[model samples]
Target: MKILVVDDDIHILELVSIHLRQAGYTVVKAMNGLEALKVVDREWPDLAVVDVMMPGMDGYTLTKKLREDTEIPVLLLTAKGEMEDKERGFLAGSDDYLVKPFEPKELLFRIHAILRRYDKAVDRMIQVGPLLINRQSYEVVLGKKSLLLPLKEFELLSVLASRHSQVFTREVLVERVWGFDYEGDEQTLSVHIKRLRDKLEKLTNQVKIVTVRGVGYKLEVSE
Candidate 1:
């Protein structure tokens, strides 16, 4: 697979590119966001590793531009590790975020995880009655309306909708949706499920999230 490395700092850019090459990935280098876009147009790399701080367009803007045009996954490599920074990166359509001064191994691991998630969801479309879930675009359409959801909520819904009527255990759902390394308890999953349920209920009566007494949740679609 080909990977694009975008960073204003020459040393950091080279460092990331070398690591990706060592992992058997073809590497394309770009100094800034504009150059990165040009490289994207030419190289058509499978994924991009971008630095948040750049000279012209920042990583967030570049991510938005890429999302607007392509389904290529983006991993934001930034020094900003705060919650708000991570939130901004995700909101800008980044597939994942890693704070700077990170281990190359960790970076590779995140890239693999993102790629695996994308592979599983690529071209996958789930329809339940009037509700439609397009995994590639992260879009949820109910009847004639599109419902926007936060990243986690969207992921949770996709997981359930992929296997509607199957009773998924809380542990399994949490692992699949939030990752096994998630530090929070099951309450986080519950909260997101609640939000998804509320949103679906507000839009349609045919699709429902049913909670099993001892188990987790299942999505039910009525014709």
Candidate 2:
């Protein structure tokens, strides 16, 4: 999963990024709200970690703006601890609030909590053709049979299934499914794609991951 971190403090931004990366999540950073929005446009993160105080667009306003169009989970991470401050944060569309001087583990806990809530809200599954992916259980069903997948492989399939036949360039898939900071190259992605396809073909050949050579890939449904 990808997380966007927005903080005016460079130290905090790097700190959060490092911790999140170590936890196996891809992290994107922004020094302020405006920059954060631009990153969001590019990364489309599953969640955002935003500081409450910024020069032009404070966390509250930014949260409100995001809520206007998207349900992307927002976690307010700032030194502001007043009851009123948290209330304002919720009113402005924050899903969780965390006070600064916080533990890295605690932050991860909250991140998982917020993401779980978001998943539940959406029913934790995406269906395309005969494939049904259960996000919570991390299982995919092709017709009546279930295929097990590793985390990265499951995420990769989720992206393709969600978009169904839409061709996705390698760069786009890397950013959307693996995060903008994906350290691997086409070889890594190709390996995962092949694994998913190999396992999927064993169960059913009704769905296929089609390669649009010189471009990218798309999921195709067959009779």
Q: What would the TM-scores of all predictions be?
A: 0.56, 0.65
Task: Say what the RMSD of model 1 is.
Answer: 14.8
**Best of the candidates, TM-score:** 2
Candidate 2, residues 1-223: lDDT per residue as tens digits? Answer: 8889999988998999999999999788998888988777666678999999889999999898788856688999879799999999999999999999999999999999999887777767887777788988999986678877899999888888876777878887877767676686669888888998898788777889999998788899887
| Residues 119-217 of candidate 1: C-alpha lDDT, one tens digit per residue | 887657888778889877788997689987888888888878866877777876776777655788768887888888999999988999999988778
The global C-alpha lDDT for each of the candidates, from Candidate 1 onward, is 0.87, 0.86
**Model 1: residue 215 alpha-carbon error in angstroms:** 57
Going through the candidates in order, what is the number of backbone clashes in each?
0, 0
True lDDT of residue 140, candidate 2: 92
